[model samples]
Target chain A: MTAAVRRRAGLRELGLGLALPFVLVVIWEAAGRAGVVPQGILPAPSLVAAAWRDWAFADPGLGLNPYLGTWGETVLFSARRVFTGFVCAILIGVPMGIMIGWNRMVAGAVDPLIQSLRPIPITAWLPFAIAVFGIRDAGAVFLIALGAFFPIVVNATAGARDVPRNLIRAARMMGANERQLLLRVVLPAALPNIFTGMRLGLGIAWTAVIVAEIVAVKSGLGYVLWDAYYVGRMDVVIADMVSIGIAGFLSDRVLVAVQLRVLHWKQAVRA
Target chain B: MTDAVAIRGLRKVFEGRAGAVEALAAIDMTLAEGEFACILGPSGCGKSTLLNVIAGFEAPTEGSASVFGAPVSAPGPDRAVVFQEASLFPWLSVRDNVTFGPRMLGRPKDETDALARRFLDLVGLSGFEHHLPDQLSGGMKQRVGIARCLILNPRVYLMDEPFGALDAQTRMQMQELLTHVWDQARGTVLFITHDIDEAIFLADTVYVMTARPGRMRSRIAIELPRPRSIDLLTDPRFNALRADILRQIREEAIKAMAEEERARR
Candidate 1:
């Protein structure tokens, strides 16, 4: 209840969360050092951290290592793609979804097409993406956008559709024209759902960027991940995987912060 | 002079999987300008459906509802509604919800804000302007609902059991608040409720409806004095009006229950 008590509770939760991963890493390190685990296949946490440090902070002139001093750029490349693709997904999805949910004609015309195409995985589009965009960043962006679009649109539709009937009537009775009703009432009402879709879409966007990077492009964490593994630099591969996880987690946190700001009333309702 | 609200042979039917369910068979009513009328009925007596028709939320199957001689074709700010659940935009603060109608009508912000303040104050929600609907109690939310409609300065107010969900004490307080508000704003109101006390306390005229296939059973004029308060609840005349309306509603409620039991069998 008190601020001090709350802070202590938060600290305890953090410590508990870290304890299991810390113990796991310690056991893993012990197994590696004792030669009970093969180091070539899976390196210790220390090795991954050391390799990540070099990849992040090492002087570029010191060695022929391709990963030297490239961690930030590699992450930026993947992050930028995810950001652009996710934005595109939101731009196309939210309006399309609102329309589909709000109007029967739009739903009839477009929903079936989206539903049918949604079953096709992003991986399935890889060949087509490479063929059309020809291994460029555009191909990666296209795949990421397409991959993230489904969840965003689907959740947006659900959000828009589930608006309370009374709220609609209340808006109409308040003299809100159709456009004003949708923008002022329906949109705000569906915002909690829109955020839900965006979070799911962002996760998919990260997946999409990696898939795009691994096959269709050359400069992101995904590219380095595959490149490192081929050369048996499992340390770099593991570090890249950790970086992707951290990036994805951080992006999700940013979205959650925005959601909290926008849907504070929704949170109060739930509380 | 055109009546504030006029309905003639209004009928509503729902074509469900079970076939056509007649909600309102035939209903007729009229309210003079600035009159406060209450429709008291048993549950499922098409009382809300009647309000919905008048509010332009639902179309009548067989007849017409008009406001100030204009056929009700669509919902508009001229006929504001205070729903049973209060239906305040959950995302909006009390101030925002109260201002919603005026804002939607493109009224000047300063004018709307002042109106919102006055109405919210009228309902005793002046300090709670920043509170969301979720944060407010049932009575407080209903106050916001009343304030929002009052802010519109509508010709008619269609309320569908606005205090039905509140506790007995809160409901009484709300009824008093509403009467106090009506004294200030003075719009024609068609309030729907099942409570005999609420009807007697608030209405200039009370229209009691019968069970399913609901039709207007009786119309009782409450000759109670203006600016009525909770003190009026214990008045001898108030008790007499309550007893009279209670008997009619009780008969309808029994019929509704019997119909339900027969349908179940």
Candidate 2:
């Protein structure tokens, strides 16, 4: 296809995606304005948008609004927590997974412990986290990393385990030493699976961050969400919810984009 | 000169839930340097098991397999394999796959690059250097598999039905391509295939294997002239060889089936 035609098609797809959300917003606004829906219970989309605008752009010196000019800081705080936690999870999880999958002794020693710990929900660990780290960022980071670790490790293990037998044999026959076999053959073979784990772990990281902010720490979008709701600032609560959704969605998209690029050979084959 | 490959009393048994199943039984074979030998058998005849033992992918339950005077203990660059599935690394480009052996051995880039180019040309995949294995057709993938193994300059080629998965037309074309390549760079080859015509067309000698607890049932030396082509397929001698192999395989297959029936009963 020509570049122009491809561009037009892409624009059409964007329009199609926006159409439903646009309609939902319009209907919501109409309902709120007509009082068909109570204002206190469910604020209009426009109210939420206006509240988000004030939160993002208003001057903090106004002293009347705590949320004013703090949107960026809160977003950054939550993002940083998620990023650090996710990185920690990856650092521990990928190698642990490879070892577990590749070596029976490692699997025997580590797999049972992981399986036992995985059943405990991140929320259940909130008290333990707060008690251990005393409501600091470390507690939140610990919770987030712990929550994300399971999927990353599990997926990485599965990926490593599933490297084709022939590929290993072929690599060996081609004169790859033990290190080369693992690094060049098994690791690359397991990459697609590792990416899958990362995506799942990232989703869990977002969840862990919100939970940590709500109970263990007193900052970020999750803290603001609970704080806004308690004060009956429903508009800010809705805005915060939207902000979290956007953040999570965008982070997931970034991961998927990276995955696509890294696994281009896989996609090329399918095409 | 030392034999390119030597096997003596090689046997393979797999311990399964049911029982110990003998895959190969007292198999003995040898390949001289630069000779193309094919092992023809029915399905489940353990032809691949023999090849795997020779390739050092599997060890025999008894006896020994050695390549070029060295006892085969592990797979190495000295004995390259072309698998039935054309198991080229999916993540690598065709060029990368073909050059993988030399690159792993830390050969100079200029030398390996030249080798890769030459073999790629020989395999009729010159423009497909950048393409991944997945993007190529079955025939093309097998060609890449051949080139990859050939690039190693191994003492022996262990092919386990490398063209078995291709369609008949593609298989014929691959057979022709293989023979053409073999004529230029002849090595010791232990090719395993079920197709009688394929065995007769490609090998200097054809070893017919028995079904289940596979053993060397018969060995027939092909007297066909070298520099063979597809036109030789119609020759009377080719058909006579085919008939002989067919009769032997049919008897073994029937024996295998009867054994299965007895076990079921």
Candidate 3:
């Protein structure tokens, strides 16, 4: 294919992706302007966009509006919590998962405990988190980390366990010691599964952060959402919701980009 | 020097949920250094189990196997294996898979890379260094498996039906490639196959094994010309060897079928 044709195809894909959102926005704007949507129940996309702009760029001198110019700070706060909690989850969960999957003794000792605790919802742990860490950032981080850990650990265990027996035998025959077997063969073999778990865990991490911010913390998008709703500022609530969605989407994209790079060999085969 | 590999009264019995299944019994074999030997048998005749015992991937229930006078206990670099499925690490590129052994042993990067390049060329996969196993055809993947083992410069090459999954055309091409590679490398090879042609084409000695509770029934020496080629398959001498082996295996296969019927009853 010529470069021009390829470029045209690329543009067509972009247009196709944006078409639905553009249509939805137009319909939403028309409904709000026509008063077909109940007043103050659902804000128009335009109104939410305006509110979001003010929340992000309006000067604090305009005063008295807590959300004014606080979008960056709030996003940062939530993002920081998610990042910290997810990192902690990865550090503890990955090694623990590998151990549980690699060794029968380790599985026997820890797998039952994990399976038993997994059934309890992250929201159910909110009270316990609050009691332990006391409505601070620690409580929020704890909740996020705990929520994300289950999927990460579970997937990692499955990944490690499911490594082909022949790969292990091949590695051993190649003079790999037990440590080398785990690091070079088993770990790399388990990577695709580990990435799957991480993606799932990250999605849960975003949810946990929003939940924690709503109940136990006062500085993020979730807090803004609740506070704006209480004040009857539906526009601000809508903007906050959109902000959270964008943040979750962008973070997930970042992970997928990294996964694609790491699993490029897998991609090449599929391609 | 001691034999490259020796096995004495080797037996393997798998304890399954159904009952104890005897896979191999009273198997004795020996291979000289730089020899290529193939174990030919019917399906489920414990040929693969015997190869695994020699490769140290499986322990014999009775008696023992040794490589160069050392008792086989665990898999090592000295006994590199080429599994039937190729078993190349899917995540690694062809170059990486080929160099896995040398890299694992912490050989100098420059030396290992040179060695990898040499063997990749030897296997006719020189241009596919960056390809993943899944991207390659069955024959190419098997070639990579061969290169991966060859890079180790092993004392014994244990191949378990290395071309068993390929199409007939690909299998014949691979057999020719194997003969060329084996001609140059000259390592002791213990290849397991149910293919009579493959056994005769590749081995210096073909050990025909009996059906399960498998024992070494006969060993036939192939006096085929050196640096053999596919044309040898039509040679009168090659035809004679093929006929003799085929006759023995046909009887074993029939007996195995009868045994299966008995078990079913």
Candidate 4:
């Protein structure tokens, strides 16, 4: 197909994505204005937008609402938790994956246990998390880290294992020692797979953050979501829900941007 | 003359799901120093298996092979292999791939860079040093593969159908480039191919192999003079050698198949 035609097709998809949300907002606002439903149970999109604005910009003389103008802090709290957990997952997961993939002994000893433990949901560990860390940030952080770690480790291991045997032999023929082979050859070969794992793990981290905030500690978008749901502030609850979505979308977009940069070489090959 | 590569009664057997499959049978051969030897055969003739044994990537289940009088055991930098697939590390830059051996062996950066640059230029990839393997075409990746091994300055070049995957034009071009490179370097080359024409064009001595349970059926010495050109392809002498090798390979392949059928019965 012509480049122009392809680009126009892509633009159409983007436009649809942008327009659908606005249409949903308008419909919800109209529903509330006409009073077609009970207002206490569900807030209009307009009301959510106003609460979002208040939380974001903190309008003049906002009274007794600690949430006003504090969107950045709440965002930062969740972002930090995700970031710390994600980094920890990568650091531990990558090396562990390499060892497990490269050595049969390591795989036999460690892979089976990790695979078995992986089936247990991160939410299932909430009680144990709170019991050990005692309702602190560490408990939330632990949950986030645990949640993100599984996918990263598993993907990294498979990636490393999938590296071509010829490439390894070539490396050895080039006088690469075991350490250099692992670092220079195996690590880079496994990067694309590892990045795939990281993206998956980061998504899990966000989910774990919401779960942790709902129970383990009282902070972040998840905490705000739960807190606003109580006392019947449906507008704030809707706004908090939107905030979580935006955070997740933005986080994923950041990852895709990095993936584009790291995998640009791969693109031309396909082209 | 000292034999650069010596294979005396070298045998290899692979244990399969059914039983022991003999990949090579008492394969005894030797290449004189700086000779260009082509191992020619049909598919499943174990030509690659033989190359791998000499390359030290596989151990012979029965006999032994040696390189430069040293017992072949494991892969080492002294011998370089060019695989059918480029088999390059995709993440490394072309220059980095070429310099990989030297850098891994702790050669000085200046020396390695200079050597890499020379080989890249030699392979006509001078302008594409910083490019990743994925960025290059299949032919270019193969060139980088050759350059990487060339930069290592290995004594023996064990190539297992390195250009077999390329299109006709690219394959011809690679063949010419290889001859040019070999002329300059003058290293021992053990080139393997299923193509009779390729064998006739490139090898000084063509060692024809029998199909599975591969043995060296015969060796044909090509007296075709050096500084060979593509024009030689149409020459009557070239066609004669090609026909002889093809006929020999076809007969061997038929015999191999009959043997297989007999065993089944």
Candidate 5:
């Protein structure tokens, strides 16, 4: 397509993206009003929006409503777990991946063990997490960390392994020591792939947090999701779901933003 | 000083999946200080193998290499290589790639920047300092690669067909740029290529090698005047050298083809 036609399509995409969500909301509100859909089963978007507004702004009245004016606190709780878990994942995972990738001895000793353990789901570790940490912040953190770690470690290993042999040779020719090659060449070269892994890992961390919060732990958006469901406040449950999505999206956006900044060199290749 | 690089009876063998194959055999060569020498031969003649061995990226099975009277054991700053591909870190800007060595060696940032800028200008990459490898054309990326090696101020440069991947026009242009850069900082360069015109145009001497399990066939000194030009390609002396080398290579190809046919039979 010509540039003008391509741009026109882009504008259409923007319009459609905005319109689609609005259309969904309108259909939902109509269904709720017409009673075509059972209100107890599926709350209208308008009702959920109102509940979210109240939960974010209106008084709690001694926590009677549970969610009232505490939406920010709940979001903060989940966000903190994800952020801490992701940071821990990166701190441990990236170096571990580098070692696993660069050293045959490390790869031989650790790779099989990691590969064997990787297929075991993070949810399976929940009971162990709860048992070990006893239904606290650490338990949720552990679950999130474990969930995020696999993608980060695996991607880091692949990235480090896939480092162009010629670049390493070039560095070696230029008299770079082993440490210099790892820190300067392998790490930076692996970063683009690592960022891809980070984004995927962050998404899993969000899911793990919700799972942990709903079962082994309390407090956070996931706890509120379950709590509101138990009390027959379907509106709050729907609101909580949207809140979780927005939280996850915003957190992923933060990672993408960070990726863009760090990979500025890769970006420069375009222009 | 002794020759910038001296290799005597150098040999290399590779353990291929099929079997052990000799890459280079009984190779003997010397590159004097400030001379541009090209090792030109057919593919798999081990021209690149020789370059790699001299750069210490690979170990020779026999014999040894010495640089400036020092026994060469491993790659050091004094010997920088320009691979066939630029191999500039795709994730680093042209400027950063050029300055990587100095920075890692703990030279202060200002010093590194100044050195990088000088080399960038020297290699005609002054305007492309901030661009990434992917942003540049094949020729431009190779220029950055040259600038990177130039920045190191290495005593010897081992360039393996640095411009071989460029288009015809771009390849000629790179040849000119290389000559220009070589003029600025005269270092012993062991450039490897299969192109006769390229070898003649760039080198003060061209060493022709016989095919696989390669050995030095002959070394011809090009008396082509310095500050050379594209016009020299048509000169009788140039064509004479090209024809001689072409005949040698053609005979090698025919002989190798006959051997292959026999093996197939």
Candidate 6:
């Protein structure tokens, strides 16, 4: 199809996707105004949007609202944590996973330990993190890293293990030594899986950051969410939830774009 | 002078949970330097196992496989291979795939680049340097496979049914291309295939193999003229050789089918 035709199709798809949500929001607003729904307990979509606008654009000096002009800082604080933790997970997870998948000894020595630890939820580590890192950013970052690590490593291991046997033989026949085989053949073969792991790990990092911020850190969207709830600012709470969803969705899209570029050969095959 | 490839009393038994399955039993073969040899057999007759042993991809369970007097132990560039599936690295462009061997051996970049151009041109893939393996046709991918091995300039070429996956027309074209390229870059070759016509056309000496636990049944030398082309398919001598090999392979194919039927039961 032509680019223009494709773009129109994409726009149609977007329109189709927005239809249900738009209708629901309109119904929700009608219900709230008609007092069929309790406004205090479940604010209308308009209320949430209004609150979000003020959270994002209102001058703090003119308003008594603590959330005024705090949206950007709150998003940045959470984003930075997720970024740091996700990077840490990738740095440690990818090589370790590849080694585990490539070598029997490494798999035997490490895979069991990871498997056992993986079953313990990140939420369960909250107390331990608080004990070690003392309710600071370190605690939140630690949880985010720990939460993201499993998927990255597991996916990396799977990627490495799934490399075609013939490709390895072909490389060896081309005079690749053990190290060269791992770096050239095995690593490239495992990349698709590694990226899959990174995407999953990044999602978990976002989750981890929220969980960490809510309980262990003093600032971020997660902290604002809980604080808004305690003070009964339901509109701000809803706005915060939507903000998290958008951030998570945007981050995933970025990772997917990178995956397409790196695995361009794969894209050609699929196309 | 040492034989280009020498296999003596070679055997390969694959040990599975189902117990030991004999693949090649007490096989012996040799190819002189610059000779083009094909092992013709029925499907599942262990012809590929024989080639694998010589390629150093598999160890002989009983005897030895040697290349240029060195006992085969591990696969190396000196014994480059063109696999049945082409098996070009999917991520690499055509040019990179062709130059893989030389680059792996740490050859100079400019030298390998020029060599890549020549070999890719030899395989008629000069215009597809940037195309990824997945973007190429089966015949094109196999051309890259051939070019990669050619760039190695190896002591021997181990081809395991490299054109077996293509359509008959493509296969014939590839055969012609291979012969043309082999003429220019001559090396000892050990080709494995089930096609009677392909064997008759390509081989200097055709070794017909028996059914499972394969053993050599006959060795018929092809006395066809060089610069062989598609026209040779209709030649009386080619048909005679094909007829003789076809009879042997049919018997083995029947036996193999019977064996599979019995196993299923």
Best by DockQ: 3
For model 2, what TM-score does chain A reach?
Answer: 0.94
lDDT of 4: 0.88
Clashing pairs in 5: none
Give lDDT tens digits, candidate 2, residues A120-229: 99899999998899989999999989988999999889988988999999999999998888888888888998999999999999999999999988899999999999
Count of clashing pairs, candidate 3:
0
Candidate 5: interface RMSD equals 1.5
Give the alpha carbon lDDT tens digit for every residue of A1-271 in model 3.
8999999999999999999999999999999999999759998988888988989999967568896898999999999999999999999999999999999999999999999999999999998999989979999999889988999999999999999999999999999999999999888888888999999999999999999999998889889889999999999998888889999999999999999999987778654
Model 1, span A150-269: residue lDDT tens: 999998899899999999999999889999989998888888888999999899899989988999999898899999999999999999999999999999999999999998887786
- Put down candidate 4 lDDT per residue, A1-271, tens digits, no spaces: 9999999999999999989888877887798889986677788876778888988888435446756887778889989998888888888999999889888999999999999999999999999999999988998888988888899899889988999999999999888989998998888788888898988999899999999998988888888888878867788888888788888899989999998888776665645
Evaluated on CA atoms against the true complex, candidate 5 attains a DockQ of 0.71
For candidate 3 chain A, which ten residues in a row score worst on lDDT?
A262-271
Interface RMSD to the true structure, each candidate = 1.7, 1.2, 1.2, 1.8, 1.5, 1.4
- Comparing to the true complex, what docking class would candidate 4 get? medium
Among all windows of ten consecutive residues in candidate 4 chain B, which has the lowest summed lDDT? B1-10
Please provide TM-scores, in order, for all candidate models, with all chains considered together: 0.96, 0.95, 0.95, 0.94, 0.95, 0.96
> In model 2, how large is the Cα lDDT of residue A259?
92
Local accuracy by lDDT, each model: 0.90, 0.92, 0.92, 0.88, 0.89, 0.91
Error of 2 at B258 (Å): 1.7
lDDT of 1 by residue, B159-244 (tens): 89999999998988888888877887788999998888888889999999999999999999999898897889899999988888
Tens-place lDDT digits, model 6, residues A1-271: 9999999999999999999999998999999889898878899988999999989988888557788888999999999999988888889999999999999999999999999999999999999999999979989989999999999999999999999899999999999988988998989999999998899898889889998999999999899999999999999999999999999999999999999999988978634
The fnat scores of all predictions, in order, read: 0.92, 0.85, 0.87, 0.83, 0.79, 0.83
Off by more than 4 A, model 1: A62-64, A269-271, B261-265
Off by over 4 Å in 6: A62-65, A269-271, B257-265
Q: Lowest-scoring 10 consecutive residues by lDDT in candidate 2 chain A?
A: A262-271
TM-score of chain B of 5: 0.97
